[model samples]
Each structure stands twice: as structure tokens, then as C-alpha cells.
Target chain A: MVKEQAHTVSSYEQELDQVRGMLVRMGGIVESQMAMAMAAIVDRDEDAAMEASERDPQVDELEREVETLSIRLLALRAPMAGDLREIVAAMKISGDLERIGDCAASIARRTLRLDAGDARLSPGGLRTMGRLVQENLRRAIDAMSQQDSERAVEVWQSDAAVDELYTAMFRELVTYMMEDPRTIRSCTHLLFIAKNLERIGDHATNIAERVYFAATGEQLPVVRPRGLPVV
Target chain B: MVKEQAHTVSSYEQELDQVRGMLVRMGGIVESQMAMAMAAIVDRDEDAAMEASERDPQVDELEREVETLSIRLLALRAPMAGDLREIVAAMKISGDLERIGDCAASIARRTLRLDAGDARLSPGGLRTMGRLVQENLRRAIDAMSQQDSERAVEVWQSDAAVDELYTAMFRELVTYMMEDPRTIRSCTHLLFIAKNLERIGDHATNIAERVYFAATGEQLPVVRPRGLPVV
Candidate 1:
């Protein structure tokens, strides 16, 4: 009977381990999608854009898988305390990761549109902003894997930097479009790509917030710092 | 013992009912926020925009409340099958509704920006698009309350119409910005507002999808029909 109980415990641990593995795989896919989308913009590579867009279905599949496993655990195991937090966090993080995938696909679609027009290179600020968001997302996922709420807080704080950079890029693009009306078409797409990247950063912060909440069983403040002012 | 069991069942029902009420309340707040945000743009009412933005904290608070309750119920009751779906659906729906609130706040901020410039009325198509999204969101919340998956599907199908309208509006605004550089700033704000409305419609569709999944115990196709090609 003792051996039987030990086996049950190990199997439960295995089930959770399966979910953790899937979450990491999903995060890796999203990271690649973001990279490919930005590369498509920076390099003007249509193939990269198509690949980024094509990868969304994989992300969606992983999100559904995570949801199924989390729900199964909730129903079957009736997890309490830390285990409950882990399963719920997995569910919420999967949803946020899926949104990041959609944002990447949105960026890829914009790159496709930019390809059809006169290629105005992404302003220098965009690449920098993209790198910031990418790093933040990477760290947030890492924090989730390690159950490190301190690292999650670090990722959350970094979002303000992304917002500041996005605002600067927004002003730069608006100025460019205003100066040369001919650039309006391409510039509009770039503005959207920038916004999508900023939103991806926001989703990363959201994941971090969930991780922190799961770890501490406390909610973060509803009002966060803002760098971009309207107008 | 039988009476105690009956009392326990009644308390469980009450707990679920409390969550249901909070979900609807959150949904109502989101709906009003969207309406006010659009009204701010249509009427150039800065006060309306500010009001809409201010309401977001309330929505955020309600989201936290719903999440806390849902997680507690999940850990304590181990609800199964349909009851489990209802709790999970409420949690997902609240998150989506909070996003819609954030999008509305985004639009409201843009309206404030538009007010700072030469007054430009929202293009004719924007109002039409706003109404369509509003109707879709309303129906989605109604479907959730009634557990009407068919109505949810109706809301899902209407998203394509919103997307088509958004593409037309996008092209129209881009042309306006190109024709006269003076319209660039104001038109950019309008563009963001339209995008926010389109996103609100997307959130409404997400709610519908969740409702359908909850009712049917089956996942929908990940690849949905999208009408707007960026080119």
C-alpha cells in the first residue's frame, strides 16, 4: 500500500511535469515567432514574415493543451494551495502566451504589407524597442519556470522602458509621415508593428504579474506606472 | 446530516451565483466604457473620454474579485463537468472583458489626443463600426448569462463584418492623411480608435468562443476567418 501511494504521487508529479514542459515549448514558439516577425521587418524578408504568421496555429494548439491539462488537474486532483496556484498560473500564462503569438502574427502581417510598398527601413529605435520586449518576455517565461517571483517583478518593471521607447518611436514615425506624405502607407504599417510589439511587452508583464500572484497569493496593484502620455 | 448536506448544497449554489453576478457586472462596465469612449471621439468630448478612462480601475478591481472567487471555488469544491465549465468560463470571460475595458481606455486616450488637435469628426465608417461592435459585445454578454451557445456563434460570425468595416476605415484614413498633411495627427488618433473598436469586437468574439466551448465541451477551430488583408 505504501508503494502504491508512492506510485500515485510520482504519477501526479509526472502529470505536472508534462504541463511544465508544454508551457516552455509554447514559450519557445512564441519567442521564435516574435524574432521572425521582427527579422522580417528589419531584413525585409517575406519568408520570415510568412513563417511567423504560420506558427500561430502551433501556439494555439499548445494553449488548448495547457488548458485541458490544467482543468483535468483541477477536477481530478483537487489541488490545494501551491499546487492550485501552479495549475491556475499555467492556465493564465498560456492565455497570455497565446496573445503574444497573435501579436507576433499581427506584426508579420504588417511586414507583408510593408513589403508591397517602398521599403522604408524600421527607424533605429524600433530594433532597440523590439529587443527590449523580447528580453522582457524571455525573462518573464524564465521566471515562471523557476517560480521566481523576484524575477517576475524584474520583468514587470522593464515594461515601462518598452513603453517609453514605444512612445519615442511613435513620435518619430508620426513626424516622418507628416514630413513626407508619400511615406504614409509604409509608415502606418510600421506604427502598427511598433504598437504590436508594445502590446507583446504588455502581455509579458501580465504573465509576470500572474506568476507573482501565484507565488505570493497576492494581487498586484491595479494601477501601474505609465511612460506615454496621451498627445 | 441530510439537512446539513442540503445547506451545504445551497451555499455552493450561492457561491456560483455570486460569481455570475460579478461577471455580468464586469461585462456591463466594459460595455459602458466602450460606448463612452466612442462617444468621446464622435462628439469630441474630452470629459467623456476622461470618464471612460477613469472607469478602468473599477473594471480591474472587479476582475480581481472574480478571479479570487473562482480560484477559491475551484480549490474547495472540486466542481465537475458542467459546473466546472461554468466556473472556468467565468474566469476566462472576466479576463477577456477586462481586456475590452483596457481597449476602451486606449480609445479614450486617443480621443483626448484628437481633441488636442484641429477638431475632426470620426469618419462616417467609424460610427457604423462602433455600433456593430457594441451590438456584438452586448449580445455576447447576454449569451453568456443565458448559456446560449447559438447566440454566441452569431456574435462570432459578426466579427468579420467589423473587420471589413475596419479595413475600409483604415484605407479611408490613410488616404485622408496622404491627401492633406494637416490631417495626419488627427487621423492617426482616429486610426487608433478604430483599431481599438476592432479589438473590442475581437474580445467579444473571444467571449463567444469561450461560451461555446463551455456549453459543448469541445474546442473550436483555432484558425478563424479574417477579412482584412493589410495590402
Candidate 2:
């Protein structure tokens, strides 16, 4: 009986580990999608844009896989306490990752609309904001895979900078549009690209909170440490 | 043993029912938030905007409540098959409802920043989109409460109209900004407001899909019936 019980326990642990591995893999796909989307804008590479958009379906398929595995564990193992929290967190994290993919695809498609000849719109603010958001996303995914609550908290705190940069980008783009009416279309796309990056940052923060809560069994923070990321 | 098993089964059913009720309540709060947000933009009522934003915390609280109960159901009951689907779907639906609240609050906050004197921006397109979105949100909520897969499918189909109206609004606002540079800031706000409403519609579609899956034990349509809603 003891031997049988040990074997069952080992298999259960393996299943849990499988879920974690899936989440990490999904996170990696999203990270690459973000990189491609950013390159699409910064380099004006249409191929990168199309490639980023193409990866969205894979992210979505991964989300469904995570959902299925988590639900199977819930039904079969009846996980309690921290194990249960981790599974729930994995589910929510997958949702956030899917949204991040959506944001990347949205950004990529918007980049396609931007005029190639408009040397008028400076992507300086956008590039900075995108880089910061990318860093936060990376940290948040790492936190999830490592079960590192402290790293999750760190990612959560860094999101405020992304928000501030986004605000600055918003104002700068509005000024550009007001000054040159001809730049309105391209500038508006840039504004949304900035907003999409900010949203990606927000979703990353959400993943951090879920990761922290799963690792610690406590809510990360009631409100964002600084200015709330809003439209 | 049979009597005890029957008693346990009834209690499990009760718990599942409770989770469903909490989701319905959360859906109701989000619906009202959407209403207040639409009123804020259409009437330019700052008070309505504030009220809409204030209700966000309640939505967040309700989401936690649903999560707690569903997690409890999953861990304690070890529900199987249809019951398992119901609990998982409840958790996901609550997440979507929370996002809808977030979009509503976002629109309300942006409306707070709109210029009071710029009669230059027309809410006609927004008004149309908002109304369509509100109706769809209502139907989606109803579908969840009633467990009507047909109603859920209806909500799914109507989302295309919201997307279409949003595209039209996007073009109209971009044209407005290009024609009159002074309206650029307010029009940008209007653009986001339209986008937010469209996002809320997307969330409703998400909820509809979840509800359909829970009630019928199958995935909803893999792709939307119309244009993919991207920023």
C-alpha cells in the first residue's frame, strides 16, 4: 500500500510540473511575439508584423491546453491549499498571456496601417516604453515559472514606470497631431501602439499579482503602487 | 451509505448553484457600470463618470468572491464532467466581467477629460456603438443566468455589429482630427472611448463563449463571425 501511494504521489507531482512547463513555454511564445511586434514598429518590417500576428493562434492554442490540464487536475486530484492556488493562478496567468498576445497582434496590425514615409512621427517615446514593458513581461513570466514571490513583487512595482512613459507618449503624440494635421493617421496608430504596450504592461502586472498570490497565498496589493494604468 | 451519498450530492449541487448566483450578481454590476459609462459620454455627466468609476472596486470584490467559491468547489467537491465545466466556466466568466468593468471605468475616466465646450466632436457614432454594446452585454448576462446556449450564440453574432460601428467611428474620428487640429485631443479621447466600448463588447462575447461552453460542454466558435476586433 505504501509503494502504491508513493507512485500515485509521484505521478501527481509530475502532472503539476507539466502544467508549469506549459505555462513557461506559452510565456516564451508571447515574449517572442512581443519582440517581433516591436521590431515591426521600430524597424518598419512588414514581415515581422505578419509573423507576430501569425503567432497569436499558437498562444491561443496554448491557453486552451493550460485550461484543459488545470481543469483535469482540479477534477482528478482535488488539489488543496497551495497546490490549488497554483493551479488557479496558472489558469489566470494563461488568460493574461493570451491577452498580451492579442495586444501584440493589435500592435502589429496597427503598425501595418502606419505610413512608411512619415519621418514626422518620432518613435523615441514608444521605443522606450516598449522596452520597459518588455522587461516587465519577462520578469513576470520568470516569477511564474520560478514561483518567486519577490520577483513578482518587483515586476509589480516596475509597472508604474511603464504607465508614466505611456502618459508621456500620449501627450507627445497629441502634440504632434495638433501641430501637423497630416500626421493624424500615423500618429493615432502610434498612440494606440503606445496604449497597447501599456496594456501589455498592465496584463504583465496582473500575471505578477497572480504569481505572487499563488506562491504566497496572499493578495499582492490592493491598488497599484502608483498611478493606475487607465486609458 | 446511499442516503449519505445522496445528501452529499445535493450539497455539492447547492455549492455549484451558489457560484452561478455570484457570477450573475457580478454580471449585473458590470452591466450597470457599462450603462453609467455610456451615460457619462453621451450626456457629458462628470458625476456619472465618477459613479461608474467608483463601482469598479465592487466588481473587483465580487470577482474575488466568485473565485473563492469556485476554488472551494473545485477543491472540496472534486466535481466531475458537467459540474466541473460549470465551476471552471464560472471562474472564467467572472474574469471577463471584471475586465468589462475595467473597460467601463476606463471610458468613464476618459470622458471626465473630454472638453466641455467642443461641440465639434459628435457622439452619434459612439451613441450607436454604445447602445449596441449595452444590449449585447445585457443579453450575454441573461444567457449566463438562464443557461441558454441559443441566447449566448445570439450575443456572439451581434458582436460583429459593434465591431463594424467601431470601425466607422474610428474613421470618422481620424477625419475629425485631421480636419480641425484643435479637436485633436478631444477626438483622441473619443477614439479611445469608442475603442473601450468595443472592448467591452469583446468581453461580452468572451462571456458568451464561456457560458455556451459551460451549458453545452463544447467550445464556442473558434473565430468571430466578422472582422477581428483589433485596436
Candidate 3:
């Protein structure tokens, strides 16, 4: 009887570790989706956008698999305290990643919408903003995968800088519209692009919060940092 | 030992029920905030906006309390599959509600921003569009609170209507700005207001999904119904 109990315990532990490993893989897919989406925006590459859209299904499938595995573990293992937090955090983090995938897909759709129009963005500023947002998203996933609270804090700190860029972009787009009525159609698409990047920033912050919860077993009060309009 | 086990079981069940009740109450508060925020937009009432902003803290407090209760339940009860779902669902639903609160406060902030200017929205059509979107938000919440799947379906159907209104509003605002550069500032604020309403509608749909999940332990695939722009 003692041997049987030990065998079952070890098997369950192995299964839990497998779930964690799968989550990290899913995170990588989501991070790649985001980066490709940004590249499609900066390069105006419809093929890249299409590829990102197509890859979204795989992300969706992984999310569903993660949820199923977590639920199965809960039923079979009856995890308690810290183990339970790990499972629950896995579930929530998968959700954040799935939404990140959706945001990427949304960006791809916008790229398609702008395909027939003349590009309206100033190459330098928009590309810089896109790169910054993607880097923040990548760091956020890395932080979560490594369970590094300090790295998560770094992601959190960078949010204000992203917001500042968004505001500047917003002002520039508005000025463009004002300067030439002809720019309206293309500028609207640019607005959508900026908004998508802002949302990616929001999702990155969400991952940071989950990391904090997983490590501390407590939700840090979500304080909207000083610089941006609290959305 | 048998009697002691029975007492503990009953108390644990009671505690779980209390947590559920609190979540429902929090949902009510969030729903009310959405309504008032929309009202402020239509009436242009700063006081209503201020009230909505103030109520945000209450939602925040409720979310924190729900988190604590959920963790405690996991630690103390070691609930089985069904009870575990209920607790986890409560946590997720509260999160959705907190986001709804944030959306409401966002609208309120825009309301305050609008008050500093006299930019009037095109009177008749824009008002009708605003009313339709607000009605959809209210019905969505009602369906969620009552667990009325039929009503939830109705809200889902109305989403296309809101999108149509948004497109029309977009065209009208763009025309107004093109016709007179003077209307630009006010039109920008109005644009933000419209976007905020659209987002509130999205949050309502999110809540409906949670309702579906809680009632049936299955994931609802997000189907983009036929009418809205894919972008």
C-alpha cells in the first residue's frame, strides 16, 4: 500500500510539471504571434499578417488544451494551497495569452483593411513604438515563464513609457488629419494600429500581475501609474 | 469524529455560499455603474460621472475580498470538482466585473473631459445610436444576473446593431471635422465617448460569456457574427 501511494504521488507531480511546461510553450507562441503582428504593421506585409492570423488557431488549441489539463489535474490530484495557486495561475495566464493572441489577430485584420490604402504612418515614430511594445510583451512572457518577479517589475515599469508613446502617436495622427482632410481614411487605420499596441501593453501588464499572484499568493492592487489616462 | 466532520462540512458550504452572494452583489454594483456612466454621456451630467467614478473603489474592494475568500476556501475546504469550479468561476467573474467597473470609470473620465468644451454631437442620429448601445449593455447585464440564456442570445444579436451605429457615427464625425476645423476638439472628445460606449458593449458580451460558462461547464467559442467589420 505504501509503495502504491508513493508511485501515484510521483506520477501526479510529473503531470503537474508537464502542464507547466506546456504553458511556457504556449507563452512562446503568443509572444511570437505578437511580434509577427507588429512586423506586419511596420512592414505593411500582408503575407506576414495572414500568417499571424493562421497561427492564431494553434494558439487557441493550446489554450483549450491547457485548460483541460488543469481541470483534469484538479479533479485527479486535489491540489492544495501553493499547488492550487499554481494551477489556478496557469489557467488565468493561459487566458491572458489567448487574449494576446486575439489582439494579434485583430492587428492582422487591421493590416488587411489598410491593404488598399496608402500608408499614412511616419515610418520612424510608429516603427519605434511598435518595437518598444513588442519588446515589453516579450519581456513580460519571459518574466512569467521564469517566474522572475524582478523581471515582471521591469515590464510594469515600462508600461508608462509605452503609454507616452501612444499619446504622442495620437497627437501626431490628429495633427495629420487636421493638416489634410485627405489623410482621414488612412489615418483611421493608423489609429486602430496604435490602439492595438496599447492593448498589447495592457495584456503585458496583466501577465505581470499574474506573476505577482503566483509568487506571492496575493493580488497586488492594480495601480494605474502616474503618466497615462487610466483606461 | 463523524459529528465533527459533519459540522465542518456544513460550515465550509456556508462560507462558499457567502462568497457567491458577495460576487452577485458586486456584479450589481458594476451594472449600475455602467448605466449611470451612459446616462452621464447622454445627459452630459458631471455629477453622474463623478458618482460613477466614486463607485469604482467599492468594486475594487469587492474584487479584493473575493480573491481572499477564494484562496481561503481553497486552503481550508479542499473542495471537489463541482465546488472547485464554482469558486474559480467566482474569481473570474469578479475579474470581469472589475473590468466593467474600469470601463465605466473610463467613460466618466471622458465625460469630465467633455465638460470643459461645448462640442455638440450631431443631435438626432447620434443620440439614437447612443441609446441603442446603452440598451444593449443593460440587457446583457440583466441576462447575466438572471442566467437567462435566451436574453443573452438577444444581446449577442444586438451587437451588429451597435456596430452599424458606430460606423454611421464615425462617418458623421469625420464629415463634421472635415467641414469645419473648428469642431475638431469637441469631435475628438465625442469620438472617445463613442469608442468608450463600444467597449462597454464588448464588456457586456464578455459577461455573457461568463454567464454561459458558469451555467454550463463548457467554453463558448467566440463567433464573429455575420455583420460587423472583421477588423
Weakest lDDT window of 10 consecutive positions for candidate 1 chain A: A115-124
What DockQ, between 0 and 1, does each candidate earn? 0.65, 0.76, 0.46
iRMS, candidate 1, in Å: value is 1.9
Stretches off by above 4 angstroms in model 2 are A1-3, B1-10, B228-231
Compared with the real two-chain complex, what DockQ does model 1 have? 0.65
List TM-scores for all candidates, in order.
Answer: 0.96, 0.96, 0.90
lDDT by candidate, in order shown: 0.87, 0.89, 0.75
TM-scores for chain B, in order? 0.95, 0.95, 0.84
**Candidate 2 lDDT, tens digit per residue, A1-231?**
999989988989999999999899999999999999889888888999999999999889889889889888887888899999999999999999999999999899889999877734777778888999999999999999899999999999988898888888899999888887889999989988998999999999999999998988888656787764556
For model 3 the interface RMSD, in Å, equals: 2.4
Q: Which stretches of candidate 1 lie over 4 Å from their true place?
A: A115-120, B115-122, B229-231
> B48-105, model 2: which lDDT tens digit per residue?
8999999999989988888888878887888888888888888899999999999999
The complex in candidate 3 yields a DockQ of 0.46
